[model samples]
Target: MTIRVVVADDQELVRSGFGMILEAQPDIEVVAEAGDGEAAVAAVREHAPDVALLDIRMPVLDGLAAARRICAGSRCKVVMLTTFDLDEYVYEALYAGASGFLLKDVRRDDLVHAVRVVAAGDALLAPAVTRRLVADLVRRRRAEAATEATPDRLAVLTAREVETLRMLARGLSNAEIATTLFVSEHTVKTHVSNVLGKLGLRDRVQAVICAYETGLVTPGAP
Candidate 1:
């Protein structure tokens, strides 16, 4: 199936450059392009694309707000774009229901792959980037006493499902989780799906956040 996408950015060159790269792919199509957040939301509404690549900072609406609107109003998956790996807004974007994020200078192959992954209903939870960003956000929240552990929220999960969520929060892939549990990757995927379904999460990104918020996983812990 073709993965229709909307590339949104304030920079005309960057927007067109990404569109060109994605348009080059056979399975990926740049259905629309937006120069700002409002247009991005509008494009998603109109195109009903599989994915929406939105810049974190844009004129008017901003990516976080746009992401929330798109996520709440449509089935399009959102992947935030930022110039910095440690952009503070990334955490909020994820909470706003973004599938994940990519740096502005992402390589062509990775960019294409990210669109495909998110379009396939997976999160762009790269171990190095996602872990660090989430850890930092958790730390800040902890310091401010803003995070209250709600262990009861995970009551619907089985013990094994909870373990799967912890491994996911640690940035382990399905295969990695399978290896640790001596189970097949298919089993890992099942557990992940059940976890998400039981917890009412959008994707693995939200599962990871839920694990942290529920105290199933702790920042800087193995």
Candidate 2:
């Protein structure tokens, strides 16, 4: 299936650059482009694209607001763009339901791959970068007391499912989680599906956040 996308950025050059890169892919199509958050939201409403690539900083609406509006009103997955992986807004975007985060300096192949990864209903985040982000959030909030093995919100999941979610928050792929648990990849996938379903999460990104919020996975813990 062709994955339709909308590229939103305040810079004309950035918009064009992403557009050019994505349009070059056979299975991906850049159906619309926006120069600001409002336009981005409008384009998503009009085009109903499968994915929306938004810059973290934009005029009129800003990417976070645009992401919130788009996610609330449309089914399009959001991939936030940033110049730095450590941008403070990265965690906010994840909380706002973004499926992925990408550095503006992303290489050609990584950019293409990010779009595909999120389009396939998976969340994308650089593991090392995301670890820092999560740790930072934990530090600022002094929520160390929040780390509980079984939070009320996660009461619906079985013990095995909770373990799967912890590994996910640690940035383990399904295969990695399978190997760690000495289970088949298919079993890990099943656990992941059940975890998401029980938590009512949209994707792995949200699941990671939920794990942190519920204290299933504590920051700075080995």
Query: Using TM-score as the measure, which candidate wins?
Result: 1
Candidate 2: list runs displaced more than 4 Å.
139-151
For residues 23-45, what per-residue lDDT tens digits would candidate 2 score against the true structure? 99999999999999999999999
Clashing pairs in 2: none
Please provide TM-scores, in order, for all candidate models, with all chains considered together: 0.94, 0.90
So what's the TM-score on candidate 1?
Answer: 0.94
Q: Which lDDT tens digits does candidate 1 get at residues 1-222?
A: 999999999999999999999999999999999999999999998999999999999999999999999999998999999999888899899888999999998999999999999998889887477877777776666677765444488888899998899999988889899999999999999999999998889998998887776678887887
Clashing pairs in 1: none
Supply candidate 1's per-residue lDDT for 107. 94
